[model samples]
Target: MIWILSIMMIIGIIIFLDTWRGIQTVLPLSAVEPLANDEKVSVIIAARNEEKSVEMTMLSLLNQTHSELELIVVNDRSTDATGLIINKLARRHERMVPIHIETLPSGWLGKNHALYKGYQVASGSFLLFADADIHFEKDTISKALTYMKAQTVDHVTIAPDLQAKGFWLQAFISYFLYGFSVFKRPWTANHDHSRKGGMGIGAFNLIKRDVYEQIGTHEGIKNRPDDDLKLGQVIKQNGYKQRFLSGVNQLWVEWYPSLKEAIKGLEKNTFAGFNYSLAVTVFAITTILISHFLPIFTLFSTDYAVQLLSAIFLIIFLALYGVTIVKMSSYSLWKLVVYPITTTIFLYSTIRAVALTYIKGGIEWRGTFYSLKELRGKQHQ
Candidate 1:
């Protein structure tokens, strides 16, 4: 028991250190200077039933510091007032151009198709594919453009400051992001070119127009459910320079309203991210449980040495989570006290994702269903 606990502690410490190192590599947008070039930038958004958030997202883009910018929003066959809201906004703001999609074509996901349509008409030197739920601060785009120019990189993605409400939701995001940092390792996205290690945040993916054209644009990743990450991977795999930035004070988005909503929200991507592999899904659930929950429970064991080691491991684990929360702009330190609850919720969600995938026989997104066979055999762009 003692040996097993010691090995777990060692593995925990190694992952903690590696995650901290990766967090440090994500440069904040505040450190970047304003753009010096007068290049034209096109901001593309794919909206489907985003009536509640589209206005704010559109207005944020309109308020950018950069003058040479165009906002192209493709309404992806919305059933609500999304198109009406966009049209009203477009009439008021010259920069906002709304394209209504009456129907979705074959051989493409809804959002990916919308993005592709927008990309075809984009006449900018730089293109930024942003989600309608994302709220950008005044200088966010300017800072991103400047950073790209300074780093001499063709592609860049900014991890948004996630706004997760309630205790369970906050903790879930913290654990989820910690795992993302450990596995995706956003730090190595630019530094290591030998491996395809780039990360693309759904909130923002800014790329050079020519680079997008070179990589075959959205057509390359048209069928991929995890388009943002896949696009970044394609960029890295193609020998292009790409960087991931921290969007602490610059870009923001409300990830989910509650813990239940998050669990359902991530169900599709969780299984899809693992390429619909049952083995990988099981491995992920096991990994989350052993890494997070095991140490805390082991602290209450009879052996004094085991308890002491468990306590040490738990503290290190909290520290690792703390770094992740701070980097993600999650200021609720009190949530750490109830870390065990969040850990349990995260584990449950992982299992739920797997079960949901099996029960539904496929992934359902935006009223579209994709089978397990289709997801497993998904071709990379």
Candidate 2:
């Protein structure tokens, strides 16, 4: 019992300190000065069955305050009206270029291959890779360029504001952000001297054309489901300067419409995040059980000493979670009331991802099935 209490305290202290560091280190996109310059930035977006949000996303890019901008929107073999929408927008707007992919090549994911195709024809000095569904403020590109130029960093990835419609979804998103901040330590990515800390957000990843090509571009990480994160890792591994930013009001993405969709959405990357290692997955599950669930269960212990320690651990846990909710998300602190419920759902999601991947021998993403053997073969940072 004494040893368990000590471990809980240690975990609490580490999470608290790390969460504080992340809050302090991540810069707000709104605070940066918006630069209106002549440097052309080619914005690349890969869309598959995103007809609902692609137009709004494209319109947001077209209306950027920065005058010199190009949009390369790729239609990755969508069975729906995504291709038609892109073509219609391209016809009306000369700045927007549309590319249609009829088939995905071997040894590559659909979205990744589509992005690589977009990059091949991009003529800008700076390249910005974004999701098809992400909406941006008018000055988002200008402000991002300002920060990149001011800092002289080779790559910049901004964590966008995750928009959720319901209370439960908000709770789950808040908890996800908290876990990501605490475990990933994203603020460390800003540390110029460390290669261990690197991050990439799919919503907004801006890189110099030369830097992107120098890192072998998407050709190197074609099979990686988490291409955004791997892009940042390769940048860091190759000794390029990288920075992470907060895009609270500047960039927004409704990650999933409901809890069911959210769970389905995470199926592709959750197992891949652990590098498809069963040992690592089991270890992560064990750690989560002890750190998150143990405290709640121990609160009902008959021993007074155990109860006190558990209560202290819960306080620290809530404090870390509250800081993330307040700083990184638009949700109120009241959402912390659902911490236990959300944490359970998160654990379940992780387990489900692992189970389904092994059972199916692969992951189904964007209506395409990628084998685990191929994914593991290309799992190099």
Candidate 3:
């Protein structure tokens, strides 16, 4: 009876997660068409060992159909020749402004510091914070800016096309982005734009200059995951309007190099979100096991009816996963066959993130070792 109750609960929760996924934000996510007068914009590229993608990003930004713009690339003390690449781009394009990071004060996190540094030199009314890995169409930025202006949104962000190159990389990233975003209701991010709200990825975000300072931008969650869902919340909670666009055709970002790279990246902030509390951590783990793994238990049961029901539910989950992938990116329908494999990676990453974030001090990013506790304290800093 107890086992039956658990299975029923899991089924109910899965249904709820899937339904909530439909409640998307009603923002202006029209197709990417060039804005009539969308100029007077600046692009800020933050990099540290991004030599591979920096040049392409510059060329992409330069080719944008917008006029009267400045592209500032801040090389954050990269040991690689990332700076040289930036300088080369600047030399080739008169509008490109390649700036070396002067020095970051002790309190600031690296990306936030680099971004703030870039903002210092920007003279445009609108500012774009794009990752070094992202590539966009000629009209992408202009179209996005026009939509923001038309809707009067202080901040606008589009979910980038998650380009998965490896099998496991495809498995894990698709689950986290498409599956998780669908489940987490990231589209309706503004409703809970506080510490309790969903986060915005810094990659491919366009914001008004005034609103950036009003909410303190990354300053609110600087010590935590600078990329934590806080930026959206900060904008929403502070009374600035914001929206998430589903423009898969217009923008794309390569999240990481390999599955190992992806794991290390998520490890840093898995615990960073939980305030490092023991009780919340335990609850989270238990919830994940129940909601995601309980169906596997159906195999050991003798009841034919229960087994059949569980199988049906699992198949429904696979369909949803496939729908998510195709909607968010250009993955084929046959990829749905790998749902179980993908979901397992998602479960494992969350569990691994919890263990490493709590048992070990904190996961490493670049070279910084920011502890979970240190991150929470730094939020107020």
Candidate 4:
């Protein structure tokens, strides 16, 4: 009992410190001034069945205050009307370059291959890799470029404002963000000396064109489903300058529309995040279960000291939740009351990800199957 409490206390303190550093260090995009520069920027978006939101995303980029920007939208063999929409938009706007890929290349994920193709045709001093569904404010690009030049960073990744519609979906997202911020320590990426911390968002990964090519580009992380994160890892490992920002109002994306979709969406990355190691996955589940779930049961213990300690640990946990929701999201702090339930849902999603991947022998992403053997082979590459 004492050992359990001790470990819980340690985890609680670590989370507190990590959450504090993240909230304190991650600056909002609005805080930066919009830069007026003549440097050409290429915005690359890989679309696979993104017909619904791709037009909106393209229009937002077209309306950016940054005049020296080109839009390269890749239609990654979408079975839907995504390609038609891209072609229509491209016809209407000369700055929009549309690429249609009929088939994914051998040994490459669809999106990654699409992005590499976009890069090949990109004639810009800077490249911004963004998702097809992301919407940007008029000044978002200009402000991002300003911050990059101001910080002298070669890579910049901004965390967008996640637009989850329902209560449970919002709660899950809130918990997911909290866990990611606490464990990943994204703020550490801003520290020039820290090789252990870095970040990249699929919605917004802005990097100098030379640096992107220098790191081997998407070809380096071709098979990774978590390509955005691995991109950041490779950048930091190579000792490049990187920065992270809070794009809360400046950029927005509907990560997943519902709880069911969110769970299904995470299936691609959650197991890969643990390197597909069942042992690592199990250890993470056990640790989270003990640190988060056990406290509730401990609160009913006969020993008053044990109950008090459990209560304190839970308080720290809730405080972390509150801070994460209030700072990283626009959700009300009152949502922290459901942290326990959301934590359970997160655990279920992680477990389901591992189970489904193993049961199917691989993951099916964007209508493609990547075998576990190939995925593990490309784990650290």
Candidate 5:
């Protein structure tokens, strides 16, 4: 039992190290560079039912510091005012083009299909695949463009400010991202050029147009619920210099409306992230339970011989989360401090995701039901 505890503590420390070693930006977005007119940037936004965020997001794009850019928004059969808002933005901003997605064709997820449609119309040297919910600082596009040019990478994705904050919202909004970053950063920063180990946050991704074609866009990852992960994998497999822009200062996106919405939002992604694999789901659940929360139950040692080990794990979790929180913004240190509860909520969300993906095989998002079985069936082909 003591040996098991010691090994667990060691593994936790390794996670801590990987996180620290891989991240080039603590906050994920304070870096800035200016875009030049030598190359034009085309920003494509895909909206399904983003009535709440569309207005602000459009306004932010219109206010971009760089004038050598065009914005195209694809309204993907939204049942709400999402299409109307895009039309309004097109009228308001000469640079904004409103593209209508007639319908979701078979075998394509909503966002990817919209992006592909948008991509067909964009004529810029670089392509920015941004979510409808993402609102940015006026200078965001130019800065990101300049940053990418300097990095000499084919694709650069910024870790944006994830805005949502009931205790649970604050806790897990970026947990998936944090895990993704830790897993891939070490190899990415080293320019390893390997066929594995690279990832990105999809809210704001900048890609060279040529690379986008090389990877095959939504068609390449049509069956995957987690398109962002597929994008990263494709980038690495093709030996491209995939990157992270840690300048999260002016990058902000609210993922959910309420606490319940927040929890459900993560549950959907987590379920799909595991590829509906039962073994991986069980391992993830057990690891989170025993490795992260056992200190509270004091199960490692009644005599508490492993007190040092417990403290180490907690501190690492705290430090990484604390740094990530600081990058998100200093709005509430108190919210970050309650991360233990937040982590428990996250664990719950993960469990729910697993159940929905495996048992129920149904994923509900913005009033649509996506079945894991159907998705897997497509993948096997």
Candidate 6:
């Protein structure tokens, strides 16, 4: 009983700290700049098998209110009509260019190589490495540039507004976002000058051309799954300033269509996030269960003090999750009740990611199989 209470207190403290940090750190999006900056901005998109969404993403980006812009779409060997769509769009839009990648080198991961290829030909003072599925509002780039200009940072990663349709999807995202805030502690990414903590997002990672070139770009993080995160680490390690902001109204992405897809989607990178170590995965799952899921069951305990404490902790946890939910999506506090389901599902996915990696001896993503040894090797700084 004492041990359980101790854990409960720790969990409550963490929730309080995480919520406070999020409220303090997440920046708000502003209106579109009435006047565009003269500095040329190059937007890079590395796409593969994104047939259904690539066209819309490209159109949104091309229609940005920013005047001096170059959009480079790298067709990373998509089996669908991604290449054809890029070609068609490039023909119509003078600023859009398409680069088809027919082959990938031995040491490079698909997305990393594709981004690197796009970077090679990019000619702009600033570079925006955005995802193919993300749809940017006309003012996203404008607002990003404005924010960058206002601050002394060299790189900015925006946590885009997530577009989740169904209830389960929203609930899942609520838990995911809260957990990320608690664990990732994005606020510290910029505050810590030790060059160790970094934060980045695929939705909108804008960097100056000089800073990117100095850090070796994607070449430094080749063959890694979470290239966005590693890029932040590299930038910070190189002693460059980076900022994270909220893009609720400026940018959005349809993260996953269904619950099953969401689970499967997490399988690729969840364990990889733990550096492919079974020990870390096990420890993580255990901690998650104890610190997050266990509180609910304690509410039914006959011990009055335990029940009271459990209820208090649960309320605090829901409140913390609600703060992040409001930040990430259009969901309300009502959805916070399903956080346990979200944590359970995420734990299953993490275990599945580990099992798949060990059983297949490698991880398969977008028609490419990366060996476990290779992935483990690249996990180090």
Ranked by lDDT from best down, the candidates are 2, 4, 1, 6, 5, 3
TM-score of 3: 0.87
Deviation from native of the Cα of residue 58 in model 4, angstroms: 0.2
Q: After aligning candidate 6 to the native by TM-score, how far in Å is the CA of 108 from where it should be?
A: 1.0
Cα lDDT tens digits, model 6, 1-381, are 756766777768776875687567777765435356888999999999999999999999989988899999999999999999999999999999899999999878899999999999999999999999998888789888887887768998888888788888878887888877877776655564567677888888999999999988898888788889778878888889998888887888989998888888876677767767788778878888887867778889998888888887777777777777776666777887777777888777778878888898888888999888887774435
**Candidate 4, 113-149: lDDT as tens digits:** 9999999999999999999999999999999999999
What's the lDDT for all of these models? 0.84, 0.91, 0.71, 0.90, 0.71, 0.83
Whichever of 3 and 6 has more TM-score, that candidate is: 6
What lDDT tens digits, residue by residue, belong to model 1 across residues 41-144? Answer: 99999999999899999999999998999999999989999999999999998888789998777667889999999998888999999999999998888888
The residue ranges of model 4 lying beyond 4 angstroms of the native Cα positions read 379-381
| Candidate 1 residue spans exceeding 4 A from truth | none
Model 4 vs truth, CA RMSD = 1.1
Query: How good is model 2 by TM-score?
Result: 0.98
Which runs of model 3 end up more than 4 angstroms from their true locations?
1-30, 190-199, 378-381
* Residue pairs with backbone atoms closer than 3 Å in model 4 (clashes): none
lDDT of candidate 6 at residue 336, scale 0 to 100: 72
lDDT of model 3 at residue 27?
35
RMSD per model, one decimal: 1.7, 1.1, 3.1, 1.1, 2.7, 1.7
- Could you tell me how far off, in angstroms, the CA of residue 123 lies in candidate 3 after the best superposition? 1.2
**Model 6 residue 34 CA deviation in Å:** 5.9
In candidate 5, stretches whose alpha carbon ends up further than 4 angstroms from where it belongs are 25-28, 174-190, 299-304, 327-337, 378-381
Better candidate by TM-score, 1 or 5? 1
- By lDDT, who's the top model here? 2
